[model samples]
Target: MTRVAVVGCGSIGTRHIGNLLSLGVSDIIALDPDSGRRDCIHQQFGVKTCEDEEMVWNYRPDVVLITTPPKLHLELAISAARHGCHFFVEKPLSDRVEGQDELVEICQSRSLITMVGCNMRFHFGPSNVKRLVSEGVIGRPISASLDAGQYMPDWHPDQDYRKRYSAQSRLGGGVILDGIHELDYARWLFGEVAEIFCHGGKLSRLEIDVEDSANILMIFKTGISAMVHIDYIQRFYSRSCKVIGEEGTISWDIHGALKFFTAKTGKWEVVEPPAKYTINDMYVEEMRHFLSCVEQDEATISGVEDASKVTRMALAARKSMLNREKVLL
Candidate 1:
């Protein structure tokens, strides 16, 4: 049995706990400062709960899942890695690039397996898009357009949107960082982003301190230009991307089918996800993948290196937005 300790028992953390239990993981421990959340986890999942993060060393967990805010990810992950524990950290890596290089170095030097919580890479739509692009079905991707938006209030109907981490800049919340799935999966399909130009602000009257919207332009190392739009004002959730290639085009949207157009066929083709596919399915698959990677001593879907690069790109976008200029990475 693998001893796993999960830090932060928030909404996402609880979801991971549920999936870990369903996967038959025994000897699970949860660490969160919030007693209410700890109580909920104990009652809902019957997992051991602790308020102290240092308890991980005593528990001797083989893996630690960091689901805390971006501000705390680096500190917790570094501590866990120092104890020779594998890690699965949530995305955006951290609010800034501070200590990221050293953290990556520590993980690599210790031969630790790490997986970032960018579940979008496991989504059926993006998975299929990667396959099609790799197969040359769309030829070489030349450009892309990606968009993701949802009303912040709708995100957590039970809580005040203004107080959530997504609405606070200090907590590493913003459309750019919170909705970073677009940037991440874009890189997964295209290549590394070399330059970025962005413009956005509290365009909407959202009662939050952070920017409510942003439009970013990225030039990948492959010279593929991509545009990304994210916001917190959409009444209905929306997430989709379109990739344009020399010979065809491929696009996908959440809860929708993949659409492709080829110059060879001159017709549109659609690829629908399996009828049973759901958003929760991605997290389950991600946990299974991470556990397997840990057991096999293999790299993860989004390892430390990829997480650091993605964080760099995100920070650059923030800088571009503030300076109102193009940032070259």
Candidate 2:
């Protein structure tokens, strides 16, 4: 057993708990300030529940997961690292770029295993694209584009979307940060970005102060040009990416199939991959990677240092949107 404690019961946090349990990790503990959320988890998952972050840490858990609001991530992570516990943190680090250096320094000194919650990397569709791009199947990828969006209210029909974390800027809950999936995958496929130009605003709904829509253009250091579009208002849930290369192009629906297109064929060609591959269990896989490192004192598949790059990109995008100009990375 990993003897893990989950430090939030929100949508992503609960999903992590459920996914961990599904992975045969049953010795789980949950911590949440929301009493009803914690009680519900205790009754349903048959796990111990703590009232706050401190008690959960005081128990000396083998592993700690920080799934709380972005503002509190660094504080709780530093606290857990001080107690000699490995951690898994959800994306964006913090709403502001403050305290990250201290957190990163402490984790490095403690040699703790840390993984960011960027599930798109675990998706077979994108993973296949990455492989193809690396294997010269598409030659050298020169440009990429991603279109990802969904209606916020439809995210969880049972809850009020207005009160959710994604609707709050103070929580680092805008589409740019919340929809960081595309940005992470881009960096994973095309390397670091050199600059970013973004346009965003609260145009669609009156329910939230945060930007519900965003259009971001990225210039990669490799001279690769990429464009990303994100929004909270959409007719249907959609995630798609297109990578253009020297000899060909790689494209996919992210939910359906991945295709490779060559100039000779003048159309998209199917790249066969295992149908059994799935991303639904990515959270569990990420958890297992973290716990195994915790047990063996090894490095995790994704480290905090790598995660820092994505956070920097998100923060730079925010600055670009604020300044109404492109910001160099």
Candidate 3:
């Protein structure tokens, strides 16, 4: 019975609470400033709720899940680390990297288990792409393209799009930061980025202050180059990736199949997800992995130190977009 405290009650927070319950971890305390959100989660899951952060510290949960907006992530995580609590923070570690080094130091000093929620790494399609690339199925990788886009309004039909954190600049809302899965997995597949150039901004009339689209080019240290396009203006949700190598190519579609083409064979092979796969399955598995790491006192797949690198990459992209010049990492 690992005690847990979830620090936000938005959609992601609600999903995590439900998943934690489904995984048989009953000791949960949900903290949210919104009374409506607190009441709703309590009614839905019967978990304890509180509006005060101090109350959560009093609960002395073994782990903390910081699902708040990006700007608030590092501050909350630092506090959790100071409390000697292992923590899981959502992606793009922070809107900026100002205090990340300190947070990493605190966690390292305490030996706390930390994980950043790059849940796409757990998704079947991306996971298989990673495995296939590592297995040399695509031969020596040379270049790749990654794309992800969806209408901002379609994200949550029940809520106003303008009210979401993704629509606010101060809250670290933008297609690049919000949809950083591409950059993360790009590094995972290829290698460290040597330089980056991005071109994008709020080209849509979505009533948001942040960039709604981005076209990023990355030069990897391993001599592999990749292009990534992310946008919040697509009428339909679309996510896919293609990797071209010396001998073949591989493609992955979130909604469809993973296809591999071999130059010698002249045939395309396909792989599909299990019959009962759902998007939420990845989130559940992500939480399960975090909890297992907590129990075993083992290092997580995406710890704070590794996530900080990605945050730096994201911030560099923003600098590139603002200055209209390529940034060297």
Candidate 4:
């Protein structure tokens, strides 16, 4: 029986715990500092809940899911690594790059199986886009565009949007860090970025201190360039990507289809996700993959070391926005 401990017990953490139970891995524990959150998970999922961090370590879990805010990620990860526990952290990895190298080093020295939650990579549309690019459906990719935005107030209707981490700077909230899925998948499809120029800031009337919008241009080491736009001001949720290649173009719409147009075919090709596919499916699949990798002591799709690069890119974009200059990686 593999024992699992999920720290945070918030929205994403609760989702993971439910997925774990559905996957039939039931030896689970939920950790949170909030008594209400701990009790809620205990009643909802029937998992053992702990209010103290030490109690989680005492449980001797083989794996710990660090779903806390970005600011708290590195510290919790380090503590988990010291306890000889493998961990899966949520996206962006951290708000800054200061302590990331240390966390990577600790995980490496322990030979622990680690994964970062960039679940967008597991989504059908993005996965197929990566595959089509790799298969050369769009020959010699030249330039690309990626955009994602959603109104912050509409995110969690049950709670106050102002209190959510996505709206707070100190909690690592902002479009750049919050929407890092775009940056991660951009690198996943294209190559490493050599330099980045970003322009945009908290241009909205949203009651937040962080930048609510960002438009970034990245020049990849492959000489390819991409334009990325992210914002929290859109009234409706929107996400899409278009990659133009020398011979063709591939595009993806979150609510639509995966499409491509090639000079060879002189027409458009479309691929749709399976009938029962839902956004939650990606989360479930990612957790399933992580558990399998942990059992086999194998590598994960998005490990800490590789994810650190994405965090670096995000930080660089912020740097560019603040300094009003292109940042070299």
Candidate 5:
């Protein structure tokens, strides 16, 4: 059995733990400073729990899931790499770019199988969009727009919104990083971004210290222009994207099937995912893929380098917002 350690028992950490258990990984341990969270993990999953990072690492786990906040990811990943343990880190890489390049180099030099949790890529909606764009179904994709928003308070009704990392600046909480799924999948579809122009701030009356909304425009090296909008003020949760091409347009959202509009067909066509598909299925698939990479010593779809690239893009967007100018990437 592969020994695994989950570094944090937050919401995302719990989700990953559940997936790992479902995938038959028996020897699992959870590490968190919160005794309540640790006890919850132990009681709910019957997994071992540790309050100290060194204690968790001493377990000699083959793999570590760094599901802590964006600010703590780098230190945990470096420690795991030093232990020759494979890593599966959650998204945005970090709140800042400092030390990430070195972190990636260390992981690569160690020949570690590292994966970043950008599970949106595993979703059928974005997966289908990537396929359609690559297959010329949209006929030379030129531009796109993506939007995602939700009420911050509703994120975890049981917890105070202000106390969570998403509402605090030092913890790397903000709409841009919190809803980074939009920026990540946008780049996945369009390719590397060359330049970006952005305008955003705490436009909403949200009581959080971080910005509540942001609008970013990116020009990709592939010559595609994309716009991204994220916010924590939307009363209802919503997410969608629209890709425009020379001959047609493709649009998709969380609750709806893929819809394509073409001048050639003079009508709209719908493409639905498998009937059994669910949102949680994406995380399960992501975990399974990561485990396969760890066992086979293979590379993952979203590796360290990919995470660094997206982190840079997210940081650039924040910079553009501050400088009120376009940033060249």
Candidate 6:
């Protein structure tokens, strides 16, 4: 069995551990500074728990899942790569503006496998969008828009939402970074983002320092324009995207399924293959792919380079928000 270490015991970290266990990975270790969190995991899974990050390195795990926080992701990932271990870091790459370039360089120099938590790409709904774009099913996507949002307090009723990483900017918690799922999907559907114009702030239902609403406009190299609306004040979680082309448009809803429209048909039709998924499904697939990469000695499914592009988009949006001017990225 491939040895793995989870460097955090927060909500997502626990989810990753559970998914890894479900995959029959017994050689697992958990490291969390919070004694209570570590104790709970030790009692739940009987996995070794340590209060030190160095113990994780000393454990000599073949893979490390850095789910600590965005600010610590680069440092942890670099350390893991230096130890000749593969790494899996969660979404939005890093919170800080610096270190991303160096992190990619280190991973490249060591030939280390790295996976980012852009799980939307692996989901059936968005995977079909990628397939359709590749096959020219939409006659070259020209434009697209996405809407993703949810109420913050509703997210964790049992725990204080303010204490989570998604609550503070220093922790890489905000509408843009935390709400970046749709941004990655749009990139997967179209091309690399050329420039971004955005306006966002903490002007919504939640009483937090971080933003609860964001509106972003992206320009792609292929002359494609896209808009994204993200908020953390919705009572119901909604994740949906619509792609428009010269011929027709295809829309996919994570809550529902796929809906198609054609000019000639003049009617909206639901066209989809068998698809069923959940948040945990992405976690399972992410861990499974990380396992396969380690076993086969192959490259990671999603590397630092891919995740950096998405980070650049988020960073540009943040810049736009602060400077009160459009930022090119």
State the TM-score for model 5. 0.98
Worst 10 residues of 2 by lDDT: 277-286
Model 2 segments beyond 4 Å from truth? Answer: 263-267, 272-279
**Candidate 4: tens digits of C-alpha lDDT, residues 1-329:** 78999999889999999999999989999989999998899999889998889999989999999999988988888899989998899987889889889989999999999999989999998899999999998899999999999999998889999999888998999889989999999999997999999999999999999999999999999999999999999998999999999999999999899999999999999998999888999999999999999999999988999999999999999999999999999
Q: TM-scores of the models, in the given order?
A: 0.98, 0.94, 0.99, 0.99, 0.98, 0.95
What is candidate 2's local distance difference test score? Answer: 0.83
**lDDT of all predictions:** 0.90, 0.83, 0.95, 0.93, 0.91, 0.84
Error of 1 at 253 (Å): 1.7
Q: List, residue by residue over 42-147, the lDDT tens digit for candidate 1.
A: 9998899999976767999999999988778889888988999999999878878889998899999999999888898888988898999999998988999999
> Across residues 80-113, which tens digit of lDDT does each residue of candidate 2 receive?
8788888888886666677777778888988778
> On a 0 to 100 scale, what is the lDDT of residue 293 in model 5?
89
Model 3: per-residue Cα lDDT over 1-329, one tens digit each: 79999999999999999999999999999999999999999999999999989999999999999999998999999999999999999988999979999999999999999999989999999899999999998799999999999999999988899989999998988888999999998988887999999999999999999999999999999999999999999998999999999989999998799999998899999998989899999999999999999999999999999999998998899899999999999
lDDT for residue 196 in candidate 1, whole number 0-100:
98
Cα error, residue 287 of model 3, in Å, equals: 0.7
Looking at candidate 2, what is the lDDT of residue 285?
63
Worst 10 residues of 5 by lDDT: 69-78
Choose 3 or 4, whichever is better by lDDT.
3
Clashes of each: 0, 0, 0, 0, 0, 0
lDDT of 6 by residue, 99-161 (tens): 889888988888888888888777777777777777776677888889988888888899888
Per-residue lDDT, model 3, residue 43, is 100
Model 4 worst lDDT window (10 residues): 91-100
